[model samples]
Target: MAMAVGVVAAPLGLSVISLVNRLQDIFSRVGSHSSIDLPQVAVVGSQSNGKSSVLEALVGRDFLPRGNDICTRRSLVLQLVQIKPSQDEFGEFLHLPGRKFHDFS
Candidate 1:
């Protein structure tokens, strides 16, 4: 039997903690800039190339289904918003042009 060893490294002057904090800082302002028009981020990759995995790791959730088959046939839209002053948030359901998710449930 053979064994494999791997090493993890961060870019110069940036630790893993700082990277996580940076992600937090970015997401903290998700819904605050409606008029400034910041470009959206789109993840594109072939099947099993870590697209879903990257998003799941960032948000720390297993919500995305595997991309091995046609199970995920429809498009998914996620809207992240700060529900209140605290760290509370909500993201679910789809939004239409004329319709409104008043409940935000």
Candidate 2:
């Protein structure tokens, strides 16, 4: 991972510095970013409370399906995705472009 990062950063001189700065910014943004806040939700309840089910429903994905219990003990968060209706004549969903999801949210 370190080698891959270095390879990508070697091409753009100033851009690599900016990338590092952006990573720092993402970590610094606590209250203003929902991307940073969603992971903080604590799914606490009794046995068979459907906490994982609720999370899967909210995120519109199978966050905790069957046979995926090995890594369920930790508090790691899954990636969140957003889809919007197409504005063009032909009906098709358009992706929200760019990497700065914090700005979009």
In order, the Cα lDDT scores of the candidates are 0.52, 0.46
Which regions of candidate 1 are displaced past 4 Å? 1-36, 83-91, 95-105
How far off is model 1, as Cα RMSD?
14.2
Candidate 1, residues 1-105: lDDT per residue as tens digits? 554568555554446445544454465547543343433457777765777667667666566666457544555544343234764343444333444333321
lDDT of 1 at 2: 50
Which 10 successive residues of model 2 have the least lDDT summed?
Answer: 87-96
Model 2 residue pairs with clashes: none
**Best candidate (score: lDDT):** 1
* Candidates' RMSD to native: 14.2, 15.8
Note the residue pairs that clash in candidate 1: none
**What's the TM-score of every candidate structure?**
0.40, 0.34
